[model samples]
Target: MTAEQQTLLEKSYKDFTRNGALLSDEAKEELRKIDAALAVVKLKFGENVLAETQAYQLHLTDAADLSGLPEGTIEAAHDLAKSLDKEGWIFTLDYPSYIPFVTYADKRELRKEIALAAGRKAFQANEHNNEKNVLEIVNLRHQRAQLLGYSSHANFILEERMAQRPEKVNAFLQDLLDKAKPAALKEFQELQDFAKKLDGIEQLEKWDSAYYAEKLKQQKFDLDDEKLKPYFNLAYVLAGAFDVAKQLYGLSFTEVDTIDKYHEDVQTFEVRDENDAFVAIFYADFFPRKGKRNGAWMTSYKPQYWKDGQEERPHVSIVCNFTKPTASRPSLLTFNEVTTLFHEFGHALHGILADTTYPTLSGTSVFWDFVELPSQIMENWCYEEACLANFAKHYETAEVIPMALVDKIKESASFQEGMATLRQISFGLLDMGWHGANPSLIEKVKDFERTQFASTSLYPDVADNAMSTSFSHIFDGGYSSGYYSYKWAEVLDADAFDFFKQEGIFNRAIGEKFKTNILAKGGTEHPMVLYKRFRGQEPRVEPLLKRAGLL
Candidate 1:
């Protein structure tokens, strides 16, 4: 058998034994109970978070309360209010509503109100509170890990991941924390000083972070989403993504009308390679509406695999909550949303290019720590002038995006990156705190989180806000003890992109190397081996640090 087949067989056997196939009958029964309970509590945790998000509303009747908001944001809020049969405007805790309010709203008290509301989701004294759920999840996960002969829940989960052990993950995070903390502290002081000078604010609070950061960014770079949105019509940005794919990997995307979609908003496309051979079916749904959750992600309806000497192409989809087009204007995206589109498209490309034999190891069915490499690396293109020149045109004038703005976008890329890195480190630390050690004695979720965040804390803590209560990525989603993978993959992406920059961003030879060794290979080999095959060396942290302006 081939080495890939051997690896798959060994992995399948390990999965069975790790899941308790080798356990005694009595232990198996206990494991079953634990799994069942985990399922119920995880569902409850997510439901409570969603309920809390939908329950709160900041209904505004005064026009002055909307100061500093962009026109599109105001119009969307007005439309929301009209739909709810209210006056003035309405804003919910959804990203489309909440992010804009915190980032751009000039009303300090109002921003604080919404920010606190967002931070307190599922952490309040109400039916939707998730404090108990958080405790139950960690304890149950710990118990299950011990039952499976692992030291901690993180140990059990990490065994199947690139990190492989809790200690390695901890050391990796701590190394990053050590490198980032000093820079983060310096950035925080600068932001505080700027906030005081700009607004005469005495002390910065959790609510002030986004607003002041946006202000400081604008002051430093003269760049803001509102000024750049005109150049990033959603359709144009998407076409730019397709063009990058075509240039990089010789793929084509053609919209089709025959495929049935779950929503009218979903657009279906047929993806093909250079020779006009079918590759994959792509589905894209972009917009916010009732019942649709916030955030963006890529998912697959079918997996690509070779069966009976026939290769089955995959069906992949990207779902995002970009702003909808209003009657007066087309759907213009913020620079952040533009990167998000490319990120998910990168994942779709992974699935589209899969050429593995086994279904289980196809496409994004790779290590938790390595999966983000494709998505995050794609975001680098959004900042590239060569890539942006293709599709970033003004909606009204058809003018290409100004080079000055492109330079600003690249300049601001590392603006407050220190603080950002620290924030991610804090989350990774918090996740490790819950699963890396025994949690049976963890009595209070907020207290536990506070202890975990003590090293990474920036703003003064709000007693009422407990992040773990609403952190569905670990409790309800697949992240679990793997939140650190985001930073881990950043290291890989930075190193990989550096190779492209050395060769050329659009170098077809380098692109084909990436597509063959990284995208098409999937989990056929270990992630590090595949990465090295493409990059010609083990990934480096220097590139990430240098790019983030930490070095």
Candidate 2:
């Protein structure tokens, strides 16, 4: 058998044995019950979070309450109210609504109200509360891990991951925390001082963080999302992403009419190589509706594999919840949304470029910690002048973005990065707190979370807010004990992008090396081995630290 086939077989065997294939029938029955209960509880946890998110709406009858909002945000809110048969504007906890309101809204009380509402999702005294669900999830996970002969759920999950142990994950997080905490404290203090000087505020609350930070960023860098949005119309940004793929990987995307789509909002494309050979089918869903969940992600409808001596291409999709275009304007993306588009498109490219034999080992089927490298690395391009020159054009005037603004975008890239790193570390530590040890004794989810967040706490704690209750990444989704993978992959992405910088952002040689050694290779080999083949060495943490401005 080929080495790839041997690796697949050995992995399959390990998966079975690790999942209790060798257990007695009675033990297996227990495992079955645990799995079944976990599925129900996890679904319930996500449903409750979504339902709670959908249930709340800050309805405003007076236009005075809409002070400090962007014109587009107000228009979107007005349209939402019109749809609901209401007289005034409406804003929900959805990111598209909530983010702009908090960051740009003038009314401090209103921002506080919405921010608190957002933080209290699934944590309130309501039918949708997830405290019990959180407790049950951790307890059941711990029980399952023990039953599977592991010390903890984290241990069981990490066994197949690049980290391979809870200790290493903890040490990695702690090392970052140690480097980041001092910087975060300084940044927090600076933000507080800035807020106080600007508004005569003695105390800076959670809601004030984004508002003041954005204000300070504008003050220091002369940049803000509002200034950059006109140049980042969604369609243009996507086309730019396609162009990047074309320039780097010889891929072309053409929208096709023959493909049946689940929704009219979804755009279907036939992806092909430079030689016009079929690569993959791509679908992009770029709006939010009544039933859609929040956030953006890339998913696969079909996997690429060799079958019957023929190559079966993959079907890939990227879904996002960008603000819809209003009647007066096109759908303009915030700078962050631009990066999000590139990130998901990067994942789509991974799936589209897969060249593996076994379906299980195909695109994005590698270590959990390694999966974010492609996505995160792609985000780096959004900040590059060479790349942004292709897509960053004003929708109204067709004007290319000024190099000055591009410089500002690059300058402000590390704005509040210290606090951001600390925030991520807090989540990683919280994940370990739940799964790295026995969670059966965790009596109160909020209390447990508070303990875990002790080292990373910035603002005063909100009595009504508990992040774990709605942290679906660990409870409802597949993160479980793997939330640290985001930072873990950042290390890889920053280092890998450094290599691209030394070569050239659009250097085809480096791009082909990345496509062959990483994206196309998938799970056929160890992630480090593949990464080394592309990068020529193990990744260095210094690159990530330098990028984050935490060094």
Candidate 3:
């Protein structure tokens, strides 16, 4: 946390505790001040992140230097070049730039070079390194939670989350690990054997993971991301999202050219209700840059809140680092990227469609476990044929995605899902290892990370590659011990979407039930209560396991 953030958090705690508002004008005023202070903390934190982050970007000149880049990437480079003063191209630390370079770049040494460079963030001997920020954040969080009368940061965050206690979180993570570790080990062994056969490599290095995984995928499934990307262009995917939102709810989006944005690529839109009343403002920042983080997330300029009487519509933004379109071709996406866009947009919908009395109870302000239900449930639509037809058009050919291709997507959906589940469980466990218990003994961070990941190791651990240094989800973002929310939410989303599958994806009654019971209710009730209202029974892991072929 920054100085400003700390100051505000202190004020909020002091004012809230002193006032102790069960109900009164002074109490209301104090609570409002607390709310306003939290808003400031949110904005300043986001601004510092964006400003400090955008304060740097790795630039390159000479078109030949771009030899390792995909053709579409080169075009994005040109776009960045034009934005900056560069003559040839500019690439940022965005995932679009870094991920492709690691997975597909022919230059092995450059891939390792950048891979290590990217991971050392907030820890490297520079201002960009975040070691102090991370440590202070954990300590401050622990302090704040203790003020609220909790033992640690995890206890504070888990109050409303589905995994209500640290013990529950530990049990949930360990149970999944117990199921997934063997499968992950088997998968790693198979990949090692495959790599040895393909290149006579005695040792499988960290850099070799994605490159070989892609090859193994193609050999096993007769399909690869490069082949599927052409069918999942950016524009059609956006249109598909619009269609889904429209069908499920009565919302419509109008692409408006009437507002200011932080970036050139960020297109703005006016969202409306079925009656065409103005609803919300949407912003889409879809390309990578040095100034931006390396993942997709939904943020808000204004939150939907009702105070006294008037309702304030939110300004929601979905930011991601997807591949850029070349002059020769429009922006095409790998299937993973396609699902990511939908997931973030679902978060946007939760914010935009928010109809609540207080900003505190507004969209996605619910329990950590339930928040991802809307987002992840949206991704399930990506695998549906009817959903694909609504978007999924070839940029050049203007043809809908082929049925055969969709079949491949569904068939491969569960491929190596056990390995994937294990990976998530490992991260969740690592998170627990950090905050669910006393991390004060962890004088050195890397040593602690090694113990946490020892059960989940596939490739040899690199001394330079530390997840703690760049783990924005825990260190910087509000996740902390809640990083397990991803897996926890997966259980909820799969079970919730299974309800959707049973009734109908676009069934108005079920959709309304979701909007009313899940999305609209927000933090008013326990997440499981809201979920059981929608699902009729307690959520089970079997649907998730069945989806992942773990069953």
**Candidate 2: clashing pairs of residues:** none
lDDT of each: 0.93, 0.94, 0.76
The 10 consecutive residues of candidate 1 with the worst lDDT sum are 287-296
- If both were scored by lDDT, which would come out higher, candidate 2 or candidate 3? 2
Spell out the clash pairs found in candidate 1: none
What does candidate 1's lDDT look like per residue over 403-517, in tens digits? 9999999999999898999999999999999999999998888888889999999999998888999898899999999999999999999999999999999999999999999
- Where's the lowest-lDDT run of ten residues in candidate 2? 439-448
Deviating ranges (above 4 Å) for candidate 3: 1-69, 74-92, 307-309
List TM-score per model, in order.
0.99, 0.99, 0.86
Candidate 1 vs 3: which has more TM-score: 1
lDDT of 3 at 99: 69
In candidate 2, which residue ranges exceed 4 Å CA deviation?
A: none
lDDT of 2 at 487: 97
